[model samples]
Target chain A: MSAAPEATWVPRRYRVDAVRPELNDTVSLELAPAAGEAPAFEPGQFNMLYAFGIGEAAISLSGDPADRARLVHTVRAVGPVSRALAGLAVGASVGVRGPFGAGWPMSAARGRDLVLIAGGLGLAPLRPALLRVLADRAHYGRVAVLAGMRTPREVLFRAPLATWQGRTDLEVEVTVDRGDADWSGHVGVVTHLIPQLELDPRKATAFVCGPEVMMRHTAERLLTVGLEPTQLFVSMERNMKCAIGLCGHCQFGSAFVCKDGPVLRFDRIARALAVREL
Target chain B: MPERDAAEARLIEAPALQALIDALTARGYAVRGPRRRGDAIVFDEVARLEDMPRDCTTTQSPGRYRLADAPGAGYFGFSPGADSFKRWLHPPQQTEFRFRREGAAFVPIESAPAGVPRQAFLGIRACEIAAIGVLDRVFLEGPYPDPGYQHHRDGSFLVAVNCASPGRSCFCTSTGTGPRVERGFDLALTELHDSRHRFVVEVGSDRGAELVAQLPGRPAPAAAIAAARAVSARCAAAMPERFDRERVARRLRETPEHPRWAAIAERCLGCANCTTVCPTCFCTTMVDRTDLAGTTATRERHWDSCFTLGFSHLHGGSVRASTAARYRQWITHKLSAWLDQFGMLGCVGCGRCVTWCPAGIDLAAEAAAIGDEPGAPSGSDAHAP
Candidate 1:
């Protein structure tokens, strides 16, 4: 029998329940599934958020993974589709395609000290993994989140960072590359904060997401700090057109970022990472 | 030729190929076959046997393709051309879905599935059939199968023609894909025009068996079957063996920073013609379009090439900043890394890349240069200390 493939690109309608401004250009859309329950997705996974006539962007699920009714995406207005998504009105309806790609390696980090590093909006995708770890605080050994923003204003989910910082057990380190007068924290690149991290190097598993340059730098520094390449994972951002890995935009050598990974082990992409234009 | 195959292989006159087209039409299929178009032979609709490029064959060299009229040539004389089942299957530009802005969000207008029309692809070469197999794995076997590709590929009928005149650039014999088709066809045809214009048909499946019964032809003589086999064997011998298929992936992945890459990239215009004509190069990008009032919109998945700078662009910039890098990525992916992604080699040895390349940049020459270059690092088990 000829098995005709069903359409995988069609997006299901979802209502933007609320559009809370996270930063000047970033908006956190609390989405509710129009029909049944929102698609159950793992932390570090992403959904293709479509801005109706605008386009689609691969936005990571930032809210609690346990919340089945709502899909939270912290979108930073970068490109055309992202700008449209960021400017989306509250109660506006949009299209959602996924819950695609491998989320952060949360299970692997169990019982190991977790080092979460974010550069710019790279923090958005990692937010879910951090929330997942915070919910089950007893499972993980030690949790440290290193975030770097362009300015203090660009720091996402500041309220939670403040709350988490008050806790002595969990280390929340936030830095700005070039902070203004209002900033009273460490001022440097994200990798600079890596040296200050006091976690046991052998047991520490770092999750880095940001610009390719930043990811490369963070991964290199983590390696120097006794984290093997395998122990370090990074969420890559590419021109992902088809979330299913068919469109070929997100191809990084053999790995299709949409399917095999948006999150991949640092060792796996090392050769390709060094290979320019791959 | 051995024991006169049980399926009743027939010796149908070359003209009788039209009857097959008629039958496919009667069964409600838009029959498409190779026909001459200016300096090239292309696949399009065919109603009569005369519509086929019987007397014309293509002469393809590196960076050149021209059709020439040759008297006393076989019915289907040319190697596979720039077209394949991809035109109808994984099309260049296809409107995936049409949506209208309804109040809050856009609602999809349930139109017929794109390119799922009942159609029959006639005169598909063995290599082309192999290409369809590659595309099938990519779009069908994956977890999220491409609906448009699957819709066209699954329902469509394939009638492949065995290669009797492979191009000068052809190397299907080495790739082990063609010279003759092994699978993925309803019917396989070998044009035997040695004595007189005729075709020896082998029924590939139940559908082919039924069609052969209705076409009014006697059982193929043992001599004609031998002639058909000889035709493909001749074509196979004509093709030059270039790349080492088994060791290609390993060699390419090892020599990423090879100096030969810069040499080839020197003449490479990065025009992307090779990728456009490549049947197996299935990289594509989506284009989102909106109406004047922004009430309606359509998303189109158009063919894209890896050589293009935009193909690898990420958040801030593209990974491939240099032409040398782009060329390296294309050849390495095509020859080597594809084996890791898809079990089969991505290069079908079609030679379309060689013929269509503006710089006459032969993949074989480039690959050989890397293999033979002095001081080139032999192995880079990257990440393996």
Candidate 2:
């Protein structure tokens, strides 16, 4: 076989200049283009971050959409690249490729009540969509944020949660799977919180992001509450290597999660989601 | 339009065949033909026509295959190898992207190589040619074409061989892909023997006819054509019992909770041997490797199987954590749901999975087992039937 073309070698890179620890294991890094303009990305789209020799990983963008100067990624240290990312200090260099995969359809939620459900590190991607809606509150109706963490230590954006709780325009509820002595809030799965909210199912749109099991259970709960399957959206996570469609690692059914979606309507993936293994 | 040619093509003797192969190489095409490798017959780069295996045969049973010595000179031997045309088209590993670091600033790097070499693959089985067609629908004609795959595929040539001997596990007839060449080849050959070994080569393209005319060979007799047909018919009759692919695809879409998945999953190691050997498995993963100077980072793309636990990892955990889930994902995707997306069957009935599997798991048997049983509702039936 002969050598492939040189056009295949170009790497898309963004720079991480600042790091902020949000929760116990979660750290948010602010990224800016090393040169030229920062790549404009959607709310739920993620980038593949390479920590030099350590490796590469798919990380969701966590900052607000209006912020063009920097890109923020909230990550938990679980694997090699994530661990290497957590170890980096401010001004440390990291390689980035793509603002890949489909993001949350904010326009689809216009003039509708928004229900945001997230668990553990899944809350990272939803944070941007939540903030984007809040920035222009008149475009949407009542906003409900339901977040669940494994423990009190894992709860992210504590400062923002307090602010959201203080606001009469937004309804924020927090839950933990296993709480410590200082915990003084709801203790149950994220799906359980769906019963507490009172909204017109027809007029509301929901966004869910978490483990596949958690997302499935959450979507089932929303359906029971009279929400149409089309009204419910979920963010899917897969082993995305390229963040582009070329590397077929992140395929969910026929769709490439890195290309078609990380965020998709529940009804769109209903048949595939019903498959036991996938 | 020109009337479809129905007359059988002429045959040429074995010694005269050397001149044809030489003519092909003289035109600067890298020719790959069958050769004995250990106990198997594999397709590899051949310098001359003499490199083709003369007297070798293969024994194939459900989940088993072995090469044995034959009585006479036979260019075609055994069954398909573990590697398929995928090794040449998609490749096992390739660089997708590269990056350069200039002091504190990391800049995007551009340095992809070049196009694939012009080559001709000789002695390709009819099933493999069909497999290539299946992949072409996926990587080329799909909504988004694969640039890397297109570059290699467009540069290569095909020379298909009719199956003179079918393996015990072979079921290309059931998959509607083989026993004889119908399409997807520049030239096709059928070997015959009456008094001496001769080959009946049919030109499928203008390029093939032009090349054949350049070779020093005589036209075949009517008796030679009859002998070639007899050999191909004998091979076709040897096809193994296969599952109803159309019915299986329908059932898999409806019966998501089939008990057969659990049974096969018990034997599956999630080793990815089946997908790796399969000609049409197109899943891949990416990697980034930096030079010692830390000045450049190369992003590499490598074949990845859905059988791995990490394939479905999310924020909190993986969706399909069990070996059972991974196995189910692979089988259901290949046989059933693939048709809905690609408008073509994913498998070519090559039987690579059956023979190459360490556990001796047969896909046809598994499909038949689950498909025959009445599927239960809900995901509670998590064990094998």
Worst 10 residues of 1 chain B by lDDT: B376-385
How well is each residue in A1-278 modelled by candidate 2, as lDDT tens digits?
33224322244456678889886667999987777777788888888777865678888999888888888999888887898888777766777766777888899998999999998888889988988998889999989999998888788888888898999999999999998999999899999899889768989899999887799889989999999999999998777766655556676776778777889889988767766556
Compose the digit string of candidate 2's lDDT tens values, residues B1-385: 1222435355777776677678778877777777778887777877777787777788776557778888784777556667566687788887766667676656666544574577788888888898888778777774446667877787577888898877766778778888888777777788776577778877677677778777666565667667777877888887755778878777777776776766777788888998998888888876668888778777677888888887777555676788877777777778876776678888888888888888888887787776778876754233332
- State which docking tier applies to candidate 2: acceptable
Docking class of 1: medium
* TM-score between candidate 2 chain A and the true chain A: 0.94
Residue A262 displacement (Å), model 2: 1.9
TM-score of each: 0.94, 0.88
**Deviation from native of the Cα of residue B276 in model 2, angstroms:** 3.2
Clashing pairs in 2: A3-B114, A4-B113, A4-B114, A5-B112, A5-B113, A5-B114, A6-B112
Per-prediction DockQ:
0.49, 0.33
lDDT of 2 at B309: 80
Q: Which stretches of candidate 2 lie over 4 Å from their true place?
A: A1-10, A135-137, A150-153, A163-169, A176-188, A245-248, A251-255, A268-277, B1-10, B95-116, B141-148, B217-234, B269-271, B286-299, B307-321, B379-385
Question: Relative to the unseen true structure, what is the C-alpha lDDT of residue B61 in candidate 2, on a scale of 0 to 100?
Answer: 67
lDDT of 1 by residue, B17-126 (tens): 87999988888788888888887878788888788876777899898888888887766777667766677888899777778988776678887654445889998888
Deviation from truth (RMSD, Å), model 1:
3.0
